[model samples]
Target: MTAAKKAQGPVLTTRALNRATLERQLLLRRHTMKPADAVAHLLGLQAQNVKPPYYALAARLDGFEPEEFSALMASRELVRIVTMRSTIHTHTADDALALRGLVQPARTRELNMFRKGLAGVDLDQLVVRAKELVEERPRTLKEIREALLERWPDADPQALGIAARCSLPLVQVTPRGLWRQSGQVSLTTLTHWLGRDDGQEAVPDETVLRYLAAFGPASVKDFQTWAGLTRMREVFERLRPGLLTFRDEHGVELFDLPDAPRPDADTPAPARLLPEFDNLLLSHADRTRVVPPEYKGRTWLGNFAWSVFLVDGFLAGVWKLAEDKESSTITFETFGKLTKAQRTELDAEAVRLLEGPLGTGLPYDIRYEKVVGA
Candidate 1:
C-alpha cells in the first residue's frame, strides 16, 4: 500500500528535497533565532544524550553559545523528555506537554509489549502511585522501578518499571540535561516541573503543519518514522488542500507548506558538523535526501550514532570530538574522498565550532583519521 502510494505523486528531483531539508532545518544558513525559539521551531532537538542538543544548535544557529542554550534548561524554559520515537528530546515546556499528549496513545501502546509483566497489576493505580513518587521529588528510573515492585511484588520488575515510564509524561530533571554537567537521569511529571496545567492536547492538525515546516517535502511514512506513530495518512489528506505536493525520485508523494523554499538542484550546501542522533538524519522515511543510498547504515556502529558531517548537504563523513585539560581535538572519519576545497571548508567549520560553542581555553587540533578514498 505504501509503495503504491509512492508511485502516485508528481515527479520532482531529490536535490530540491535536500535544499529544502537544510533550509527548513536552518542549515541553509545560520539564523539569529534564540535557542529557546529554535527548540520550538525544530519541534525539539533529538536528545538521546546531553550534548547533542547543544551541538545540533551550534550547527544551525549563528553565534550559538552552549551557555545560552544550557541556560534555558537551567531556567526551565526548555526541558528534556521522551517525546517522538520514545527518545529523549529537548523541548519547550509547552511543546513537551502538547507533543506528549499527541503521542500519548503510542506511548501507552508501548505497554502492550510488556503485558505479560503487567498482568494482574492495576495500571490506573500504578499511574497515580508513579506520579506521586516523582512529584515528591525527582526520582531515578531505578528508584521508580523498585517502588513499583514494592507494590506489585509478583509482577515482572522490568515490566512494572517500563509501565511507569509508558504511563507518564515524565521530564528528566535538571543537572541531568544541563551542559557541562553530569548527573543521572531523574524523572518527574511535566506539570510538576512547569507548575501549570498540561498544555492543549497534541492536535494532529498542528503537528502536521509543524512537521512540514521543519521536515517536509516529506511523505506520510517519513512523518510516522520521525514521530514514532503510524497510520497518519488521514491527517495528511485533510491538509492536502492547503499544502503543495511533489514526488521524490521514487515517486513518493511529499507535502510541504505552499510557500516553503524548494531551491534548485544546483545550490551549494555548505559543510556542517552535526551531533550524533541529530533529527535531520533520523526524521525521514526515505533518508536519501540527506544520506546517499550507498552509505546506508554507515552512520552507526554497535547501535551508536556517530556524530556525522554533511558535505554538499548529504552525510559525507562522521566526526568525533575529544577534549582534555590541555587541548581539544576534532577528528573526521570520512566516507569518501573530499576535494581540497571541501577539506578547507571542514577545517574552517571545525575551528569555528571549537572556538565558538566549544571553546575550552585549550589548544585545538583537527585530524583525518579515515578520510576514505583519500
Candidate 2:
C-alpha cells in the first residue's frame, strides 16, 4: 500500500477565514511593523482622504512617527496617486504602478460615467496637453483646467478637469501629501512623478501575487472586490501553480500564500482603533471577517466617509469621535456585550489613539456605552 499522504488541517470556516484576515491585517492587534511595511502587507493604504491611515499606523506600531511616512512619500519610496478604484490612495511606488496596470478596467468604467461631460473630446489630444501642463511644474486642477480652456474653451472647465482626473495618468504633486502639513492640491503625470514611462500592459498575475502576499487567505471575489476589477478568472488560474487555497464552509474558494501566517482562530486579539478607510476593513468582499454584521451599516454609511472602531480581532461594534474646543472625546458604542475589563481595555486604547496615534494633543473623554443605552 502507498504511504498515506500528509494531510493539511480541515478547511477553514468563514469565521476562520475572517480570523486569518484579521491577523494579517493587524486588526488582531496593533503591530510593531513600520508604516511602509504595513502598507505593503495590506497591499496599500486607502488614502483618498488623508490623516486616517497615519492614525491607523500609530495605533498599530510602537512609537510610529508621522515623519517616517512623510519621508517615504518625499523619497518616492511610496507615492500618493489616484489608482485603485480610480480613487486617491497612498501606495508603494511599485504597487501604484502595478495597480495602475491592474485597475484599467475599473478606471475605464469610471471614465464612462463622465462620457457625456467629455463628449467629442479627443482623449489622445488631452493626454499630450495634460502631460505638458505638468511635466516640470505641478499645477492645481483649476490651473490645469485654465490651461486646457485656451485650447478647448467650448468644454466646461469643471468637466475638463474631471475628465483629466479620470482619463489622464496624474498624481498629486508632493508637499501636498507631506506629513504634518497641509498644502494645495496639484497634479503631475505618473510618468513624470515616477521618472519612468507608464507601462499600460495588464499585469493580472503579478497583481494577484501581490494581493495574496498582503491580504491573502482571501477569495477571488475578495480580490476582485478589493481591486474593483472583474474578469480575473484567467489570472487566478495562471497563478495556481504558485498559490495554496482552500474552500470555506460555504464552499467559496479562498487563496493565500503558502507561507503566509495563519494564527489560531482564538488568538488573543487586543482592542484596536483603526483609521477610517484602513485597508484591512475594506480588503474583503465579505467583511464579516473583521467587522461584525450588526455594526456594518453604521460604520460603512454607504458613502466614502468612514468611522473608527474597536475590535478584538473580530468586529465588535462602531466607534465615533466628537470633539469640542476643550477636549476630543471618542465614544465606543458597542453592538455586543463587553465585560468590565473589556470596557477598561477599550477606553485605554481609545485614549492612546487620541493622545498618541492621532497626536491631537488634546485630552480625551473616552467611554463605552451600551448601544441602546443603560
Candidate 3:
C-alpha cells in the first residue's frame, strides 16, 4: 500500500516494526550481495571497533568471507571514517565522502561539546595544521595531539586532538580496519585518502531519503537521534508530501520511502549474533521496535558495550566468545527462559558462526549461563 494509504490503516504492532526493520537490515535473511553493495544498502556498519563490520556482514551476507571485506579496505573501495554521531563507521568510499559532508553539522556540534578544553586555541589554525600533518602522513591521534601541543602548549591536548578530528573529514587508515590485521588508529583527510578533487558537500534532501530507506518508517526524533542533529522536524515536514506516513502504536508519525520493504509481522526471523554497538541497537529513538523492555539498559556496563544476539527477532541476551588452542566456546547469558527449540536453534546458529564466518578449524561448543540479575 502507498504510504499515504497506509496512514489510515491499522496501527503497526511492535512485532511488525521489528520484522520490517530486519528485512531492510538484511537480518531477516542472509543476502548474497557483495560486501560493498550490502554496505551501501544499509548506509554503513557501526564500526567503532575493527571487528564489528566483519561480524555484522557475516551475519547478514551469505557465504561472507572476511578477505572479501578486507580487500575492499586494502583497495580503498571501503573506508573507515567518523561520520554519523561522530562515531567511527565503515562506509563505501562514495558514502564516506557524501556522508561526511552531510553530517558535518553534527560533527560541529560534537566539537562544541569539547569547547571548554579547546580554549585558547585558534580553531581555524588548528584545522589547517592538523590537516597538513595527517595529509603528509597518516598520524595516530597521539602523534597529532603531541604535534598540536607544540603550537598550543596550554590548551587541553585531548581537546586539540578532538577538535582536529571534528574540524576535518578524517578517515581511520586501512590496516586499522583490515580483518585480522592489527594496527594503530591513524588518520588522513577523505580527500587525501580517496584522491578526489570534487566537492564533498551532500544535498540534505538525498541524505534524508537514504536514512528513511535504511531505518525508516521512522519519526523525526529517530532521524535526529541517529544523525546527532537537532531540529530535523522541519526537514521531515518539507518532505512529508512525497513520503509515506504512518503512526506507530504510540501515535508517533513515521515517514518512509514509498517502495521500501515493510514485511508481515509474522515473518520468521532467525536467531543471529551481533557485535558490540551494532547499529540495529543504536539507530532509533523508539528502540522498543527492536529491543525488549526487559533487556533495556542491560547491554551496557560502564563504558563497555557487550555483544548481543537476537532470538525471535528481539534482543534476547548477551554473548561472549572464548577461544583456546583446541576449541572456541560461545556463551549466551539469557535474561529469561528459552524453550528447547529456541536453545537448539541458537546452538546450530552458533556452530555456523564459528565455522563459517569466523573460519575457526577448532571444535566449538555453545553453552548457556543464567543471567546475573534475573
TM-score of 1: 0.96
RMSD of each: 2.3, 3.8, 2.2
**Which pairs of residues clash in candidate 3, taking residues 3 or more apart in a chain or in different chains?**
none
lDDT of 2 by residue, 80-174 (tens): 78777666788777677766766766877886777776666787898778778888699999998899888887777787787777776678867
Report the error of model 2 at residue 360, Å: 3.6
Instruction: Evaluate residue 219 in candidate 2 and report its C-alpha lDDT on the 0 to 100 scale.
Output: 77
lDDT of 2 at 33: 87
Question: Model 1: runs farther than 4 Å from truth?
Answer: 1-9, 371-374
Show pairs that collide, candidate 2: none
Best-performing candidate as measured by lDDT:
1
Candidate 3 — worst ten consecutive residues by lDDT sum? 1-10
Q: Report the C-alpha displacement of residue 270, candidate 2, in angstroms.
A: 1.3
Task: Give lDDT tens digits, candidate 3, residues 314-372.
Answer: 99998998888899899999988888988888887788888885757888888999797
- Residue 317: error of model 2 in Å? 2.8
* Estimated TM-score for each candidate: 0.96, 0.87, 0.95
Q: Which 10-residue window of candidate 1 scores lowest in summed lDDT?
A: 1-10
Instruction: Report lDDT per candidate.
Output: 0.89, 0.74, 0.87
